[model samples]
Target: MLHRVRSKVYADFVPEFDATSVAKIKAAGGIILGKAVTTEFASSDPSPTRNPWNLEHTPGGSSSGSSAAVGGADGSGCAGSQTGGSTCRPAAYNGIVGVKATYGRISRYGWAPLSWSLDHVGILTRTVADGALMLTVLSGADDHDPGSLREPVPDFSAQMAEHDRPPRIGLVRQYYQDYATPEMWAHTEAVANLLAEAGAEVEEIPVRGGPPVNHSVRAADYGPRIRAGMEMGMIIPTSAYLKAQRLRRQFRADFSEMAAKVDVVMTPAMPAPAPRDLNTTGDAAFQVPWTAAGLPTVVVSTGLSELGMPMAVQFGGPWAQEGRVLGAAQWCERIAGLNQAPPNY
Candidate 1:
């Protein structure tokens, strides 16, 4: 999806998807799957694809087709986007695994920016192992994106295998209980119980006022940054954007402190499932704080709601801890026994 978008927007953007990308895939013993549709510019615009589980509902977007393609009968798994909940929401809506890595973990060089500060490349798959496989292929620093970090990308799949004992997991008390729907809250509790039964020490903890600051900073920066980028040909405002950066630093500090006590944090990827209408994508409130703090988050489907829509729980870790985060999410996914296929293909 991102490859197609980049190729369309920038003429100079040569997509690796052509013979070269395909050859690379084959060389690596992979296959060329069909292309998935993306929201224009990978923004708020929803795609026409319906939820695989129920044709009457949306599959979620910008990575709409990607999520649907993964959750749908093709079941190849998805590589979605997140500038808010684009990836997480759709994965939950379609009952698949979605991963929103730490900001800058995956190079954003080819992706069209919605909110430069908030945008992230994420994956949606039916299993945590598949998600990790895609991440291993896609992650790494790219020269084209200056913001892309130079850190070595670890073998995420191997990390998932290394852990024997369950780690201490922190349950975010505020957002999960406050914003989620009754069904969502119930699903979350069931997930907590499953994690505990799997030997994880699940403890409820208060996430301080970081979410509000995260929302505010993101709100204040997105509009102005995009406007300035349009009018003056810049990606972000150097001055006002500083506030978001500074706030992010503080957010990282708070999250790091929390991580010191718990190996991983569990929260819902979105407050609820996909909205009824495709005209508007659902809120990304649950995901903002993680993006703001530059932490790695993996969305794993918990179960289907009474309405048959999907619900997911987010497993997160401190910056540069992608391996640990993916491992824990895989653990939770196994314990929950959620591996259902969506209804539509």
Candidate 2:
């Protein structure tokens, strides 16, 4: 397979070994369906992958091709990466479930780096159950990846149907309300009401921090070297990068303290439905903080926009609690009763 991070620099390049996740899948008798497209070096550049729901709209980027493939029904699941919402953003735009495992939860042995500290192996599937199953199969300790989790991988499939009565869902209504379109936000409130009437303990919550992606990935691991002589800007001081890392850890701690108050935290998966322009992917503001904090998050499509584009709700829990997040997401998905699929292609 070509190891081009969507750049011509390594157009003809082939890797000596499959990425850790790919190798794991292959060993488990999974098929290597061809590679999907990504943004240049998994950065902001928009890829050619179009939204399966609407050709004019974007299938959010970095993981654009993976999401488009699954959302269009060409594939059941795909592995994307997220530094700043690359995975869930595309999955939400495409009307599918996307899971970003906790930082170091899944080994990243051979992924082309966008940001070493922020990159995560992302899973996109038509259902939360499928996403959980993929997460189960792909998760484990890896000798090659120092960052790989040592925590035991449980049977996420078995945990799908298990929920402890009604969940205590902390809804981030006010913070996200400002970000999402009024229609979409109203729809979310309706969904929350629906869940509450159905027996969930729902309560509105507020958060303090905003986007931290601008301070992320001060040095793109292995990514910058491949780009070679591009004149981006002056090199950042190592001290600044360390400071960012420290702040990220503190943010994670703060987020965990807040998350401990509820079963899972909820928000609009995207600010709005997929935008029409292909020049840029949809906003990552909602998903960025979670990524930075190294938290596990899952998004489930709740309904369609007026234009028939997909709108989704994002669920997250404390770090290393993917099971909690996934379980809650599965419940929300069923309650929403929206099995969204793009128009036949």
Candidate 3:
């Protein structure tokens, strides 16, 4: 029952016990929802699951099925992972709320490894408040995972308050503007303005140097859109891997110098709406840098594209600062006020 379908390679395999995430959810009185499909080995291959927003479009992957489940299923909440935008991207494509907290904040025991250094457990919920609640239940130390944080988990739901301070937002527009479609770029700008109007202290904080290139470099620089998860692990030389990690540290260091300045860094969730092609999942480019820096990031759906597809904006906060990030996102989500099911397209 725990098989990760791979053309009979793992068809007969079953786990001795539930994954830590599943066990925790059950402990919190969450009824098991059974398994949802991810891509084969949670990689490049697209799954049979269709986007609930538009049957012809992709829901995004390798968490595409999980995204579709949450965005489309009635009274559903889903969980997925992001080694590189797999969780949040799919959630945006399917028009739902996606939150990936700071790396190592959530335990990864029993999760099939894509990149242990980069993988993060993410949740897809319909509201930011729900995301905060789940983070509280799912966070804390795990002896099974050395990377799990040992710090006492805070009351995440309490952090959801709209209390005193207006958030200070940094507008990041480099890679995002370069890659985003025209409509998406304009939408992002408009949303930034809307947030500003709502009293957020928004400002253009354009970054110039030292972007996180290590994660993609380790993923073979993403030259070709293929699922090289396992291949990346076995084939790359130790020296190259070590060098990438070093550069990753530099990226994190450079960002930390500025992360303390902004309550949240804003960007479009994805370059464009879910593409019509099913051969590939939507791009992970926009989501990658934050994931690479291991910053807490969340995607809140803004509305639909002209083609009636969903669009969203991503809000990333300083490392280990999920509280501020999620709170700001909840404020923005309320101001946008455009949540809806897939329209009759």
Candidate 4:
């Protein structure tokens, strides 16, 4: 299924042809269910879709309806696009699984671009296994997309099932734990313990990256940071952009080295649960660094927060290593077993 924000375009605005990603789905015999509600241009502007857990809360964007439909009973699954945290954030909010495949892993030919450099085709599904299947089908190079990778697509389903031993998990705690709520911190620690008990090697690791992305400019507000980032993007000098790109490459190198030592890096998907207020999509701090590095990330519902909102943990692997991350998430999902329906569902 497809989902777009009403504010970004007219309800009847139809594209002339299917995006490469959507066409692939059709080739695989998958039906196009329908479009879900997205924020304007998949931006920070809120969409009409509300959290199923609580109508007053945000379902997240710009994949608001994509995640909502998966968590609730609307559709089998949906395709979501992310520039910042559009896909994973909503999946985290709605208590499902979302995968942000490596940049260029999936063709973005027909999808509307948010940031040409940052836009990534993401997958949202009810389980890690489901997400893996979708990724395998959606990934490939397209001549139309210059950024699409020419790398061979692996059998993710088979690889995800190949693990016989627990995988090593590196825990990034510096900024994630420091910025997260107390309850979130405790919950994350509990997950770590569970993983360790399952025979996985869980160790605290200091990330070489400068700082974890907090995105917020104030104590509890993220609006200023979001707007500021957009503003800076508009006026950013070409030289400055190049310098930033170089630094991003360095960060990716550093992270890949870390991933070489561990099967995956674990962090909170967000600093907190989905906010009750509808004025915003929750923070993207925890998901940004990985996204910026063009690494693959998958989020699985860990449990519920105090307000009964979904709290999720994200696992990131080296570029093109989505299968490892998905395997770890599948293991965690089985351990957590968080399959409860929303209160009003």
TM-score of each: 0.85, 0.92, 0.91, 0.92
Off by over 4 Å in 4: 8-12, 211-232
Compared with the true structure, the alpha-carbon lDDT of candidate 1 equals 0.73
Runs in model 1 with CA error above 4 Å? 1-3, 6-27, 212-239
Clashes of each: 2, 0, 0, 3
* lDDT (0 to 1) per candidate: 0.73, 0.82, 0.80, 0.83
In model 2, the worst 10-residue window by lDDT is: 225-234
RMSD of 2: 3.4
Better of 1 and 3 by TM-score: 3
Residues 1-345 of candidate 3 have per-residue lDDT tens digits of 011323233456787887787788889988766577777656677878799988899989888777887788544577788878888899889999999998888898988776678888888888888888888888988999877877788887787674224688898877678889999999999999988888989887866464555343344433233436555566888898888888878777776656777888899999999999888887898877778888889899998899989999998888777888888888888899875887652
Worst 10 residues of 4 by lDDT: 213-222
RMSD of 4: 4.2
By lDDT, the best candidate is 4
Off by over 4 Å in 2: 1-4, 214-233
Which regions in candidate 3 have their CA more than 4 angstroms from the true location?
Answer: 1-7, 162-165, 208-235
- Pick by lDDT: 3 or 4, better one: 4
- Per-candidate alpha-carbon RMSD to the true structure: 4.7, 3.4, 3.8, 4.2
Residues 4-109, candidate 1: write the lDDT tens digits: 4522344465555433223333565666577687765565555577887877787777678888887875756555678767787778787888888887878776
How do all the candidates rank in terms of TM-score, highest first?
Answer: 4, 2, 3, 1
